[model samples]
Target: MQSDPHHDSANSVELPTPTAWPIITAFGLTLLFLGLVTTLFVSLAGFLLGLIGAIGWFGDVFPHPKHEPFPIRPHDEWPKDVCRVGRTVTHLHVGEHGHREQFPAAVHPYTAGFIGGLAGGAVMAVIACAWGYLVDQSLWYPVNLLAAAGLPELSTASTEVLKQFSLAGLVVALITHVTTSVLVGLLYTVLLPMLPAKREWIWGGILIPLMWTGLIWASLRFINPTLNARFEWLPFVISQIAFGMVCGFYVFRSTKVSTQQGWTVAARLGVEAQHPGEKKP
Candidate 1:
């Protein structure tokens, strides 16, 4: 028999094994989309299954009394120099005595993203006003178009008459535009935390905005005939792209996670920053 120098049964950790909850949740979402194309029964079934799967997944993600608290790997056990979660970067550093410490880049992203969206919307509104002034000779022309969604009569208002500000139109337009901006900002906060830090633009800027624009253009007539009739491709494209960039700005740079607690979160998320034995980091 070999003598052991280091052995501690009490401090030994207990981790959860691999789970199929994610697969189940994915299957549920797939059915939900399929239900959109098929029947209500199918959709309902999908929704129920997805809800169950999601609950299970969440349960698995959060710590349970059965599982031991997560333990950090020692300095010599680290696999990489850096690992990123959301926008937080965990730098694995070794000290003089070979003690390891994780330095995380901390930030608050949701508020920043919302603020960025508001700023971006203001910029877009200004640009729209400029376009209206130069081309239509009416500062109120752009706002009136948004107002026309609810007040159909504004669609046919003469340029001369529309040049003067319509209080109703301004109110409607501001409400419509600001609401859309806030919704998109909220979406950014949700999605940024779920995506890889390096591919922020791919999902946040290019893909999501492009997909949203296409959907909007395709459904414009059905969504709002008055606005559809007056849609201009140039300004629409510019504004969408600008909005995405501005939204991506805050989401990419401002999200943060504490390295210690974040390690467990990253592990649960199946991010590349997980510990060596469980998965590749």
Candidate 2:
């Protein structure tokens, strides 16, 4: 009663649908553009942090299995189940020719991490920009600057004196970088999955605006009006559309590429795998 490796488990005779590429290409192009647009503001650190998250997510997926593909026995007699959790696959059966991806399942960890972090960073960049505007006003900046900056913190300087020094401005900048980095990294690791998959069309589209708007709104509602005045509250979510679109394109294309290349989507639910260390195939 085992199924053919070439066929899908659902129908026993059907090939799993190949992924659609148009969506992916569009998404990737969109991201590249968004990355360009965001070069205007935000620290580079946020993108770097987001990249780490992405790399980690992609690297451990579908490790290389060592066992050869099954069916040293007849196709019908091949062992249907080979993969288990925490197992490492080093080989795979590719159309009767034993082939391999030539890399560990952890391939491109840094690249994935970098890109994921970039996205995470981009989002946080927005939040930071929005929130920074709120934080930059009046006494708050001076207080935080004195505490966070080196010279100001070490010196018994008056608030007026501290405001004139380089340390205060530097501290604010450092705080900005740290806040974006952490926020973006957290966004990638924690928030990304909570939303629907990136290409869910209706949900994905609406979520972009909804999220940015909420962040912007939250910034305004909580903060003093004086600070909010400095913030450039451009169509709030208009920029986020580019971000969302970019993420969408990656999800669509990367997913398709994985399928076309005989890989499974890491984000998919309960999908089984066939690793290389099997005794039968």
Candidate 3:
């Protein structure tokens, strides 16, 4: 007979239910915002209340066990089970106690960033090829620029001089583009998680790309003067903006964790706690 791992009857431990710490913390934050216009003592009171509530809230959310708990590494470090889903693990088929279990923590940012970066790089490469074809009637034109920039013989050739497509150039351009795209994607993932969730599209997708475009434009002379001279300013600018937006979208979508899960998990634990011997509904 097959064992029902999902419904373990041997182990039964109830967990604490959600308390009012989060609500209290929200109110404290509201007071802190209003304190800027109100009296000094009001702000002080808000701060104190916020601090206490935050401590209580965290304790309530993840209560410390009387006995030492087993140390579980971040989700990224855990071994993959039957599911091919890299770090966004939903279940551990067989845990330390030899039973099915839910993943202890949420997905890591680095994992999300890596995936986002690859996606962004692919989109950027497609855009580059399309833009190059539109301008020069040949996809090899811009790629050749990247190759020519590295090779002095090709670099010295006049704009009028047309050389055969360079395999070396294609390779160089692809590597450079992918490396830069992945780095930018990783940066977006790191910053997005820490930042307040507001006006994300404008700040992440538009403003950041604009800033990167200007920086690249300014540094072109040092990076590759020949390529700088060869590059069409408008197409390059548009491509960079497109890359940023695509990368931001992927990063934003991948790294989100819902607070609702916390409540659900807590509620499940509460049920288990209330009826340790009975099967959970």
lDDT tens readout by residue for model 1, 1-281: 01221332454545554688889899988999999998978889989999999999888767642244346567588687775656854544442321233332233456876887787688778878888888778888888877877776676676555677999889989999998887788778666656766777777777777888899999988766766877788877777777887877766677464344334556658775654432112
Q: Which candidate is the best by lDDT?
A: 1
Which lDDT values do the candidates have, in the order given? 0.71, 0.43, 0.66
Give per-residue CA lDDT, model 3, range 125-217, as digits (tens).
777778877767777777777666567766776654423576766787778777777887888876755557686767677788888888878
| Candidate 1 Cα deviation (angstroms), residue 4 | 62
What clash pairs does model 3 have?
A: 14-273
Q: Candidate 1: minimum summed lDDT over ten consecutive residues — where?
A: 1-10
Residue lDDT tens for model 2, 196-278: 57445344345754776677568663342433433345434554554555443333333211222233343233365553221
Per-model TM-score versus the true fold? 0.51, 0.30, 0.50
Residue 233 displacement in candidate 3 (angstroms): 2.2
Q: Model 2, stretches more than 4 Å misplaced? A: 1-114, 119-167, 174-182, 189-194, 197-206, 219-226, 246-281
